[model samples]
Target: MNAIQFGEPVSGKTVSARVSPAGGLDILSRNEVARLRDASGSGLHQLLRRCALAVLTSGNLSDEPGTIFEQYPDFDIQVLQEDRGIKIELKNAPEQAFVDGRIIRGINELLVAVVRDIVYISTQLESGGFDLDETVGITHAVFEILRNSRILRPQVDPNLVVCWGGHSISRDEYEYTKRVGYQLGLRGMDICTGCGPGAMKGPMKGATIAHAKQRRKGNRYIGITEPGIIAAESPNPIVNNLVIMPDIEKRLEAFVRLGHGIIVFPGGVGTAEEILYMLGLLLLPQNQEIPFPLIFTGPQQSAAYFEQIDRFLRLCLGDEVSRHYRIIIDDPAAVAHAMVSGIDKVRNHRLDNKDAFFFNWALDIPLPFQQPFRPTHEAMASLALHRDRPRHELAADLRRAFSGIVAGNVKEDGVRAIAEHGPFVIDGEADVMRALDDLLKAFVAQHRMKLPGGTAYEPCYVVRT
Candidate 1:
């Protein structure tokens, strides 16, 4: 690969080069190549370009997608099909993605993942390869996407732990997440997350040291993201294995299906959305028997955060929702121990049910949780957030409410929608709306809604009784 310096006066230094696929997407059909190269109103090139930029800009802190695009407006990528293999051409790309005119190896692999998933989803999944209407079909599609990424192992025991939390968090909370990760890593556990900074990076960072001390080989630090959220939360530098699902619902599904346990830290609406999604599934009658481990933890200072979450869950879904998870405060060792013990139970449960260790096929996720939610103003306004619905149903709608808030806060389309329209109007039962308003007020006051030190946050949604 050679860097071709261009004469473009830009804010940051840009590089142009052609790099071959490191270990993915080595071969593609003529049609596939054409689809990737097609730069029209109806093609995959724009999507490919956006995702590729996100991979190249790994470790970026900005949650706004437009900022990155505006910074590198001249940046472009082209997929060149050749008999030997495929070559990706970068133009005016982020200079940080390269060193001394050579692309970073990890970044290169992740870039290839961008190309692979974008092409595969555009050609295969969206083209009748999977029946997305059925719940089983959706689960199968998630499994296939993960399987294609080659992260799933057939002979491994249950050790993967998924960590969820806000990208914006306190230094103390971040350190606590790392400590918990250190303990988990010393016990030979792998880590998976949304693949951004803050809590997501902390566990992987701490685990690296522990993994080295224990001489653990082939350790996986996986990051799963969707197109809508990837630009806002680029895969952190520690993410060795990154998979881009088609959307948020599938992304969340992949997390639960692939992970043996989960640890949730203090976070904002996005984190709450993840918690509710998991709880919604667990509340289902069929999932009651499954041995899945869920834990909510943080530093002592953040105890009230989890308490508020607990209260909101109870208020929205009833007291029974508390049975599905345990809260541990300021005890990383205990958190790791609980996860280790819980994973053992998960292993036995899978074996008893004749399920695969790499993927939890026996977990019953209802269609509501599997379906992708498009959070338009009308859709957000019409959510069935009343307590009269079933607990699972209410949890699903509540999850959607938070999901829409996340979109408005970060995702490109949602931000644009909020700009064109006003804040999303969320109406529910009087008590539920009051509880939600209180919880959201706490999040805003704690600076959980956006990266700390940014300008004061404006509400993205109005909760109405």
Candidate 2:
């Protein structure tokens, strides 16, 4: 691994280097090599470039995917296979990803992960290895992705807690997430998050300290992400296991399947989408007996945030939906204790059912929830957000509405669609629409939905009542 001292004219902080992958993959077939090197419209080079750049500039808070590419227009990476292994060649890469003259090991592993996942998914799709047309096929695809990443631990118990929340959460909320994480870690639970900043990062950060104090070894801090959202929310430094799913739906499914329990911190539409997705599944009659522990928590200052979420959830799904989760504000220890107890139940249930400790095979995720939701204007307007339908179905559409707004707010395609087509119009029942509007407005008011830099938060969709 060698580095050139001179920086590109476009950026002074950038450098060119040849570095070997720390982990993930060592070699690729002749066909895979061509697919990666091909920069044409049909190739994977552009996607590789995007994800690799995000890895090179890890921990950047900005969610603007366009701005990053614009900032480093000359940056490029190539996968070169040698007789022994492969070497990653970089041009105009972010220097922060390097230490002195060498690429950071973690960043290198993440870059390898980018190459590995992109190649795996693309290869599977082309070879018809994934059957996305049906429900079981989708779940199988998710399992295969995780298995290839090698993050699953069959020998381990049910102790991974999936944490969800807004990446741009407030300082108080961020600290609260850490507190919750610390308590969970002290009790021997590992963490998995979206692998970005804010709430996604806090739990992992807190757990590191607790794990050290407990002298725990082989602790897993896994970060699950999708390509579209990767630039907006780069994998945080704490993530030792990074797995990139093909899309958001697969990523969400990965979370539910991999973790025994989940804790939701205060967040924006993205968090809401996660909540709705989980509730929609739990509300299913088939999932009624499943004992997945879900807790919503924040500091005292953020109690109102949960309250608003609770209100909106009840109005949208029904009061009975509350049975699946519990809210514990200003109590990190209590939240952690609850999660521990809940996971014990999960362990016993899994043991009785002869299920795998690493994956939840019993969770019945329908095809609708597993399918990729393109937040196009027409798609957004087509979502049925009213409560006249079944609660799970409504939850699914409501999740889509929030997901579209999320896409518009962060994902490159969603952002471009919004810019070209204007904000999406979300027409639903009067009361439900009003409730959603109020909840979103509150999020904006509380600064949960922070925009790039100082740009004020703007609505990406109009909730028509």
Candidate 3:
């Protein structure tokens, strides 16, 4: 948290800043540095700019990705190869990220992480450093990205918990997440999430207080995100460590590989996508024996929400799939106790199998799930959502269906695609389609599709029954 030396503040909503590396990475090659500032269409500049802008304007409530960029149209960022090391050059950046003419330390650290990850993935992966075609290659790439970001630590037990839910949720559900997080923190567990507001922010918020009370050190509030969704759900400042994966698939893989257990709160399509992804992984015959704790919990008011989710899951994946997760309502202490208990089993399993404490190397992530899914109109229509296929395969398709809705709703490309092509048409089994339609309707009725203050949401997709 040293005093920052940034350019003179401008009079408007933007300011000029130069951020030195606070953590993760400090040095970079000249070519890599150049690409970071390249303004060409294929260069990393635009990707860097949009993602960096999202981080600068942390705590934004808009689910629309383009809104923030429109506000700071002239905002830009660059990386400089300095004699000492690397320095980030910011022009017309959000002034809110600064405090008394200096960039906030936590934000600066996260900014460095964003820059570090972007540069690493762009330079190394693009140069064929990691083969991403196969499942093993993809898993290795995720591991390397995490290791490079310094997110993986040795000699640590299985205590990191991943919490997933909508960026926009009701106040009661959000409070419930915090209560669960406080109890988890008191038991010395770390927190990971998508790094946005609502459910994502709540757990970290609660954990901080609990960590302080317990005099915890090196408390990890990790936020894993991607470029496409950064604007829609900006990283909250409470996130001490942030890793921007190459894509949503990689981001989701990072969650399962890094977290010892998972707790899901009520959310819209994005949350449903996560639940499906987890179940799909566990349902695999190879992964059936893996002890991955999954729990869905919320306030009492959201009981029907989980019930609907449970029903949809059963209709799609069959009753046996219920073994993969537990649905707990209105009991924060009980949820925490369950997570701790599950993680204990995880610790034992990892020990008996000789797996690393930081990474779940034994868990199997299939090629279908590892590959990035482009939620195009055609892709949406081509999904195999019928029950004739294997349960895991069907789960994967359902996950993709929700993923498309998420993209169309928030991600810049998905939003633009929907605008140009109209709502995506999801063709699937009649029963499954009925279940999905009903569940999505519940999300909309509960105002979970978008932030409460925004305009009423028009669904970006239509399921063909």
* Best model per lDDT: 1
The estimated TM-scores of all candidates read 0.96, 0.97, 0.96
Model 2 regions lying over 4 Å from their true place: 1-12
Candidate 2 structure quality by residue, lDDT tens digits, 287-316: 999999999999888888888899998988
Per-residue CA lDDT of model 1 for 1-465, tens digit only, reads: 011111122246799999988997779888888888889988888888888988888776677657779888999999998778899999999998888999999999999999988888777765799889999999989998999999899999999999999888888888898999999999999999999888888899889999999999999999999999888788887888999999999999999999999999988999999999999999999889999999999999999999999999998899989999999999999999999999999999888888999999998998989898999999999998889888999999999999999999999999999999999999989999999999999999888888744477899999995
**Ranked candidates, highest lDDT first:** 1, 3, 2
Global lDDT for candidate 1?
A: 0.90
Candidate lDDT values, in order: 0.90, 0.88, 0.88
Quality of model 2 by C-alpha lDDT: 0.88
- Candidate 1 ranges beyond 4 A from true positions: 1-11
Deviation (Å) of 371 in candidate 3: 0.8
How far residue 253's Cα lies from its native spot in candidate 2, in Å, is: 0.4
Q: Which pairs of residues clash in candidate 1, taking residues 3 or more apart in a chain or in different chains?
A: none
